[model samples]
Target chain A: MRAVEPEIVVVDYGAGNLRSVAKALERLGASPRVTSDPRALLRARGVVLPGVGSSGTAMAALEERRLVEPLRELMARGTPFFGVCLGMQLLFQTSEEDPRPCLGILPGRVRRLPGGLKVPHMGWNQVALLRPHPVFQDVPSGSEFYFVHSYYGEPADASLALGTTDYGVTFCSAVARGNLVATQFHPEKSGPTGLRLYENFLRLLVLEEARPLPWR
Target chain B: MLAKRIIPCLDVDAGRVVKGVRFLDHRDAGDPVELAAFYDREGADEVVFYDISASAQGRGIMRDVVARTAEQLFIPLAVGGGLRTVQDMRLMLKAGADKVSINTAAVQNPDLIGQGAAAFGRQCIVLGMDTLRVPGSSPPRWEVRTHTGRGGGRPTGLDAVEWAVRAVELGAGEIVVNSMDADGTQQGYDLDLLRAVSRAVSVPVVASGGAGDLEHLYQAIALGEADAVLAASIFHFRLYSIAQAKEYLAQRGVPVRRVPVPSGDR
Candidate 1:
């Protein structure tokens, strides 16, 4: 008997290193479909919204593909969703980089990181866990993760913050609200600790699949 | 606090790592992929593959090396050397380079910086600056050189500090300050140049081309104000392992990431 890998949909908004995210997922034994297709996302066991573009461009790309509503609905419907960097930023309603409105999935706004340090905050930084989430399973406290961002998520509800990191001041680096998990750092590019995060998220999807749904 | 990154640079020429680093794990240091995996296990914060492949024939091999290394590395992989077009940037990013450093081409065409930043966020578009102290300039000006800091072409006459500030304005997310005169000296970094550029630009500045000891690394961060220090000979020769460097930095209050050491070595 052959084991089955979950079909994780890597959203391609025409921005972001989708190939890198997909390759990372593949390395973890999951079949990831890189697509802008709403239908693929609708049936996806997990959705990874990865980005490396300005918020305006990423939103415009999603709007161009008519995926704005579908994406919001998918995340709202409790799919194992993951957002990274600008992907995490776009989950909020607005950004300092651009005036364009985002998905507004999470009740927050993306603000520029503290300028007292490097604007990009590019390099390895450690995150201190405020609360345990499934995503950080097997990850050590203060394990370094690679980061490259000018902005970070400022969730309106501070309770949603799962982890906090410091650039100049302490800010939310990872957030968890139900099954939707997002990180200010690129876990995919963060080495073994990063791969462990992906593996943990995959296990969450597998667990969700194994759960006995009330409807079923 | 953000931990200072210790990045070991691999110079790839004709599809092989040319630095000749003999690792206890990997048999061939020339194999970029194997060496990358070894570094990954060694607790390296990131790995930079400086592709020195100048020929068209070597481009295919370069991409293959990047793909295989990317497959194994979970850390940020930065690629540079002869990336002239947006397509070249896209190909490497798709092949798994977390960032693309454009040096010579960026100098020839300044718009490439903005175009890259617009197409693929500024985070991945690194402006690699090779510098040289001009012979007869007031205020001790440093000029930008391309083609791996060869130092004999159509001189732009753009001051290094001004070039860095302008590059940031042009959407460059990061700046790598490589001193051509100090490239192989291993004396120490050009602190005056680094402090000037770091003060001029808000983006992270990576100090490259000169590093002989652990003190050089700490000084690059503490005195030079560099966000990261890029070294080749020091790391390749095992003069200091990433773990040891981080421990030393941590002891000196430099805030370096502690790369976990192998049990047997302990």
Candidate 2:
């Protein structure tokens, strides 16, 4: 069966960097629609929750848009969801920066990186692939991805980690469990290497769409 | 495994690339678009365009320059100087700058950092601090300066290292600590200043100002632990090519991205 191009829904919770993320997706030939509507997110074949701000504000925005429950349901239904930076952190149970709790999709606490190594780990750093995953299909094992974050998600399950990076110590940079894929790094800002990853994501979207209806 | 970065800093004034002797004396460097393209081809990991002109005329010029440079350069471009509002940052990003750096504006309104980070992801915001070494101390204290190293009214009085840590906490993803004392010296990096800031922040620290040669670049990464090094005279004058600098660093056990040379050249 010929694969249908997947429509990408970029969750716009008022705090995410939607423009660049959408531009990157469009470059990969994926139809991207930046929307706050939970229905659009539910209907889309793939969801990209691209965030850039604080955990508290992000959570508030998601809750305000009423996307929290729908997103959880989408994840449970095996929708291909990719989160970047704060979007990735929001997948956890809670964050130290904000008092409010997170989605509790991933079991972990997002805490600040220890002092002396810098607060926001910015710029491009190398990603060491831990396990084979579709998102990193064509990407090399030690490919560099741009990262900018202060706190990182410490997922309770080690098996969920797909890649790890070292700043002061080895920390999870990308995570994958079943159909959910998220990266702490901003693949949109990571140049050609990053663009390639997005392209690979589009390919994954094609595969997900080609699967039998019952499985999908 | 952190990949080393090659960054080229363009001093923009009235929308033109300007180079100076001590960050005070100014001379036209080149068109930002042309220079950015040159650096991109020469294997620059990233490019920074510092708007040296804070005047109304300079702002207009910077907007045009940013648009032009962003069109040609595919790598990350960080634009700074005179960014005071969300609009200022928005203008630059819309004009093609991937990241926006704030120095004076950030000091004036500390919340601007968080606001900008929130508006444009933290990865797209940079805090550029102009630091000076205050004499007569065991560790030699570093202090933040503003207004092109001119009148900022008694400095911010914040410790440079501590301020960097706080800046990151406030949502600044990268820190560029430019040493006023080392500016235009072309001797070496202000190791003391670089080390203190690097030790304080976990994010990538870019050492700007006094880089004279390949050794200086190597020292900044090795001794100063800088993730990236920014220089003006060396690259602006064609004293060293980006590939040559990377080659020198690679020989010294410093990990750098290997740019494939042309087959004929090989």
Model 1: how many Å of interface RMSD?
Answer: 2.5
Clashing pairs for model 2 are A117-B201, A117-B202, A118-B201, A118-B202
Most accurate candidate by TM-score:
1
On the 0 to 100 scale, the lDDT of residue B47 in model 2 is 89
lDDT of 1 by residue, B10-111 (tens): 998889888668665547867889878778887888889898877877877888889888876778899999899999998888888889999889989999
| Model-by-model DockQ, in order | 0.63, 0.26
Worst 10 residues of 1 chain A by lDDT: A207-216
Tens-digit lDDT track of model 2 for A106-211: 9998888777665567666788999888888867788877777888999999988899988887889999988889999988767667777777777787888877
Pairs of residues clashing in candidate 1 = A191-B74
- For candidate 2, give the lDDT: 0.82
lDDT value for model 1: 0.85
